[model samples]
Target chain A: MSDRMGEFDLIARYFTRPAKRAVLGVGDDCALLQPAPGMQMAISSDMLVEGRHFFAGVTPFTLGHKALAVNLSDLAACGATPTAFTLALALPRVDEAWLQGFSSGLWALADAHGCELIGGDTTQGPLNICITVFGEVPRGQALLRSGAQADDDIYISGTPGDARLALDALRGTLALPTELLAQARARLEQPSPRVALGQALRGIATAAIDISDGLAGDLGHVLEASGVGARIDPEIATNLIAGCAHAAAAAGLFPYEKLLEYVFAGGDDYELAFTAPPAARQAVDAASRKSQTQVTRIGSIEKAPGLRLVDAQGRSVTQTFQSFDHFA
Target chain B: MSDRMGEFDLIARYFTRPAKRAVLGVGDDCALLQPAPGMQMAISSDMLVEGRHFFAGVTPFTLGHKALAVNLSDLAACGATPTAFTLALALPRVDEAWLQGFSSGLWALADAHGCELIGGDTTQGPLNICITVFGEVPRGQALLRSGAQADDDIYISGTPGDARLALDALRGTLALPTELLAQARARLEQPSPRVALGQALRGIATAAIDISDGLAGDLGHVLEASGVGARIDPEIATNLIAGCAHAAAAAGLFPYEKLLEYVFAGGDDYELAFTAPPAARQAVDAASRKSQTQVTRIGSIEKAPGLRLVDAQGRSVTQTFQSFDHFA
Candidate 1:
């Protein structure tokens, strides 16, 4: 960096562009944006640390996508439409190759969702990525955490356990066949935010949250927020893993027991877990079809006090499960 | 960390509060907001890292204030009214004292500006605080960096060199009287953002920018964005230092030359540097008076190609500045 190595030139090279949707972009001290008229803006932020959130050997391309993806997942959980985001990145040095790969991945996903990059900060430090995303929902139309009612049908979108399996395989805690590991690894690094499904469920789902800190852990947030408990079917939870049904009868990736452990307790699956009244079942099915995403009915919200997983005979079998926590 | 020690509990302990202005706040996937009708939103992000941004021994309260203040300064430059913000923090461990101090500092400044913390994420990792702020400006009325014209009267808010002086004193590069050191240190740690001054200058000022990374370097951004240049009065620049006039005639903190060096090129002064056409001089003076901020005329924007500081005799004396670069 030189007296002549101006910050604007660096930002202009990597981050600046014509304001397509925003009123102003990176050259200004603050970016100017106008959310679509008469809409409420949905805002969320998430930070990714180099070591704790990802392996040091991870490429910038995947890291960039994952960072933005996680924030988008939060927006997805809110039943909000994605619009724009800002990235605050700390880097050890200016590596043009890294920036190139990172920006490529970032813009690709951003463009796909029509979510523009508005503004952010770049600083010198160890690698850390934080992104804050903004989306919009009609006023009072947002699906909230407190809306789940007693007897609401609890549903989850897509597969939820692949990412955890990939993490375990990478950590050497589990071994996987090459093909299965590649699939799981991709799932871990490039988990898609259920944006369309969330939008579809807006009117149907009573409450929703994206699964980040494991199914049981995230569902607990909904339970606490809605003042309701849930009874999940253990066999259904195990079957909810992607391709688990096929793998179980053929080349099982892990024992049924390990699969259940990863499915219910492993964190970082960017899928949506939602609650909708049973009366909206047809609407839920239509939303799933419209979004081309699968919706699985795994349980129901109850007026009882605590979350429980029931065996096939409806007996509680929650003894073996442990929820993931950030601190303990 | 155990299953009992979750991220949500920690968020509630420190940050979960009913958002008075936000449509939806913490505990949801995304906080919801609506800027006043027909207004454009101003967005900016800033990240502070341990060691690089602050000393490890720095008080959490001061660190929190500085972190949010810097981002607020960005909105000030754009003449936006502060609205709300989201924070993404990573911590080494939970220290309740640190959390209490940091939250108090953060809330104090935020409340003073009526900027609410709507939502954010907290994770266990090395300490890093990244905040993204949203503000609002009447549509099409925001101050822009690209509007400066040649020969516009250049002005700066308050004194710009105090923070750098405090930094030098703290680093043992310079010795200051005890009382002076305390004042300088406060300037270094709690540089108030010129939010009111910026908002006041919205229609009157031709271009504006917050001087954080030294006057010349940051003003360089305005010059580049507006496709203009500048000629500075060297003596005026040196005299712009806080308490310099009083200190110069007494036991000096350092040689006059060294003081000028810090005044001209030293960074972290959260002052506003802006330009107004000659026709708007009266309006500029009224704005300064209304905002209660000292606005000093330092130089003029030039049609010439690059920035130059001229001595009393009107020849170039800008050779000493090595404009700081984060990478360098």
Candidate 2:
């Protein structure tokens, strides 16, 4: 079925549709959408490169899913609901099987999330995927990093540093227990976007950001935005490390202090980290229960503006920080 | 500066802003935007590759401007008002001078058109640019290709085939008249998006699209969508073909019919082509008078579903049926 069509025909077959909630869709010069009542639209974009963002041998299906998933995670961080998306793909050459798998993966996520594919452009070049997602939130109601206030409690959903370990296993830098390796691979390939948790925190959380660049780096973003400081417990991070052989080896390579640094600085975790006032802790706890996600308190926002990692003895540890940098 | 700043800081320095109408712009997880009252938002995306879309040595400034310009032109085809844009760029490395020039060009256009830089992504890879633009139009009033009817007169704005000619000149395949070469280059590098013309046609034109892929190929899109055919005059197309020396040389390399073929099938004109009822002809004529641009009535819609081009002797020209195919 893929072999029978070219790019233009594929677009016309799969993407072109009349305006539904949209004022315009694929057929016209541009798509037109009407924002829902009393809501401002949230817009974000992300680009995935073949060698940089993912391994070259990974299936296009997983690539597509991960590409859109990362951008949707941004929407989740802002406490917005996904609405629509546009894709721009640059490929070295037309590969029917790759395109079929890619579209299938993209459509799956779009359908499940109720996000419509509205516009896209395909061209010949190195493999590159750029997606811009649109969502809706009530005006001025979006959660922002700058909203983190001094004395607010900082909490993170799910676990951290698992995706980084998965990458190590993939790179053959370490070995992993088979069962745990598979689970970590799945986490890396298809992350569960924290949309529900983000929406749940809209009214109660003081500030929030998705943990894409590991806990330490992303939390630093929140701290910088809010003009505050934080002192995180290293024991809690060490406990959160997944029990896999590769993780164990990677942990062995690092000193106890540096192991915690990996949890803080390694990236690709789509978990949400947020701050809330002390008064809202009970409500936050209840909301997390309702959302079926763990909300673990890690620290407190401080009046000063530097990040400190504290040992069990309550002494500051100095270590180099390493996080994913697009240009690096 | 480029080495010192990572992706986030670069975004903050260049893109973060609170524009006049934007509810939010840059810095956050997502940008928030509000559409004008009673107006539907129009959206379009285009991806430009370093080698395929433009020459390798093309300035970053022109590349940035052209990327946004082409998408904005799509909104113009829909008769919509410009509002906001998102950019997705992949690069091998961050070059400060390149980024500075690119951002300057993007911000210049955004400021001129009242479109804010709302959101986007940056990643590492071969150079590729994907830009999505948003605009607004009255509800249910967007210009559409499916709205053309039989017997409606077809009109095209500006001259055709210049960009293709300029491309040939740039590749050293053909020598162009010095005066014409500069004009052709300008047409290719800095396309004048038909925003005003589109706004003027909001109530009068039956159907419209921008002439990106020459006159004949794009008109065919309208014909196919509207379930109609067209009969265009070759003499009228010939009159619209500037840079005749290049055209004549190109004709020699290919065939005499090839000149007409390029005029009909060549793209990147970014001019408006629309079908208007005979009753609205006077209004179109009056509107055309306001600009130096000439609006030529070159064809009429037919009941059938194929395109035909007639010579001065009134014989159908088979070669003019050829059209540009992006994938082919």
Candidate 3:
């Protein structure tokens, strides 16, 4: 900490780069960006705290990746193309090695999406990372949570519960094989934002949301906004946990009850949950193939008022699950 | 904290509002904003940490105002018109009174500029406030630090150093009269960002920057970016502290040396320091009058390589001042 560079030098060394998409970049009072004509800017902000958001001993590289990934996930939900972002970070003290790893991970993800690093502030305090990301979408074409309608087919991109399984293992509440634990841990740490899939779903999906606070909770947001309900097939949802379906059933390792809970209420999975009319199923499939991401149809939107879990015969299944809440 | 509202309830009650300037406001994955055609969006972010930027027990109202005010000052420096902003806040615990007071203060200032609150994240952690503000400037019309030229007259808007004086008084390092202390403390807690003045100077001033890290250091940024130096008149600069001129000279309240130090090295003064060619002095005066903010000419940009303090006779005077640094 004592040997670390000053604030300006630290910013210049790690974050400063030539502007490719922005009219003005770092080192100015404000970064200037020109949104393309006929485009609307989509903006979102996310904050990651040391203990609340991540474990105390988590590596800086993954922390960096997850911080920006969460915000980018919001853009993905809006069907926007990545543009630029600003990072405001508070550190307990300056650590060059940590900074190097953090910035490397940040730039890797940013470069993959052609998102420019713009202007932000860095200060000394408890470790906190806040990123505000900007993206552009064609006017009136942004996928919104309020756009869902009855009879729409509900779909989710990628798996959603592996992160929670990993967290359970790390908490010593569950036992897992070493390789399985490693694979699940990566899901917990390095969330990949489905930017391309989001863009591909622009005209197809009626509504979308990023699954961060568990499937049940985040899906609730879309339902509430769209004034609709959903009926999810429990069998399909339970199988949405990658690699766990075969391993758990074949080895008779984890209980079915725990797997169900993880599937519904496992938070921190940066995947996309979207809804589209049944008529657009082929188009949705094409979008999935275009983005090279798998899509799973696990539910259907309904005119009812609450979420329901049903069996293959459409019989309601009673289950109690608690979604993640920051205040709670 | 245990009895507080849930995260979604808290946000819906306090932060959610109807969109006026933004295409979409709170309660969305991402807020949509449409900049008027041919306008460039100017963006900036600033983070404030408790125990570093503010005292442990500072009032929530002032903290809220100062947090957004500082970021608005950045837009002011760029000569942009405020549009919208996002706030990502971390709190140690939930307090209804704190939330009410903070949100009231935040909305009061935000409404003054017609800036809408878009989208952000809230979580449980050590207290921190990070705001990313957006504004718009006509293309190629932003006031930048790199636009200064030799012989440009440097000006200061409003008064500087009163906030620092109040801070010193609070620290018990200085003694000020009761009434004077109250006035200065208000300046420290509730700064008025010169938004109108910045917009007024858009086509007049060559370069501009807000005095955050003290006048000397922030001015250094303009000078470095413009590849120019400056000569400041200490006598004029020292008198820029509000209400201190007659009080200090007549009553001998504070030392001249300390006053000078505060004038140049005092941070947290959300005032604008700008430069304009001498030929535009009348236009500058008109801008100052139009914005209802006072402006004073205290220095002149030069072709030399460093800042120099000069007496009335134009002879160099030796003085050293250390600007505030987060890690220092």
lDDT of 2 by residue, B12-101 (tens): 776677656778777778888888779888889999888777899987787777888898889888988998888888877778899888
True contacts kept of 3: 0.86
Error of 3 at B53 (Å): 0.8
Q: Candidate 2, residue A325: CA error in Å?
A: 1.5
Ranking by DockQ: 3, 2, 1
- Could you tell me which residue pairs clash in candidate 2? A23-A32, A216-A264, B212-B268, B214-B266, B214-B267
lDDT values, one for every candidate: 0.84, 0.80, 0.89
Best by lDDT: 3
- Candidate 2 backbone overlaps, count: 5
Which docking category, incorrect, acceptable, medium or high, applies to candidate 2?
A: medium
Docking class for candidate 1: medium
Candidate closest to the true structure, highest TM-score: 3
Ten consecutive residues with minimal summed lDDT in candidate 3 chain A? A241-250
Say which docking band candidate 3 falls in: high
Off by over 4 Å in 1: A1-9, A244-253, B1-6, B244-250
Q: Deviation in angstroms for B206 in model 2? A: 1.1
| lDDT (10s digit) by residue, model 3, range B9-62 | 888888999999899999989999999988999999999999888898988888
Q: How should the candidates be ordered by TM-score, best one leading?
A: 3, 1, 2
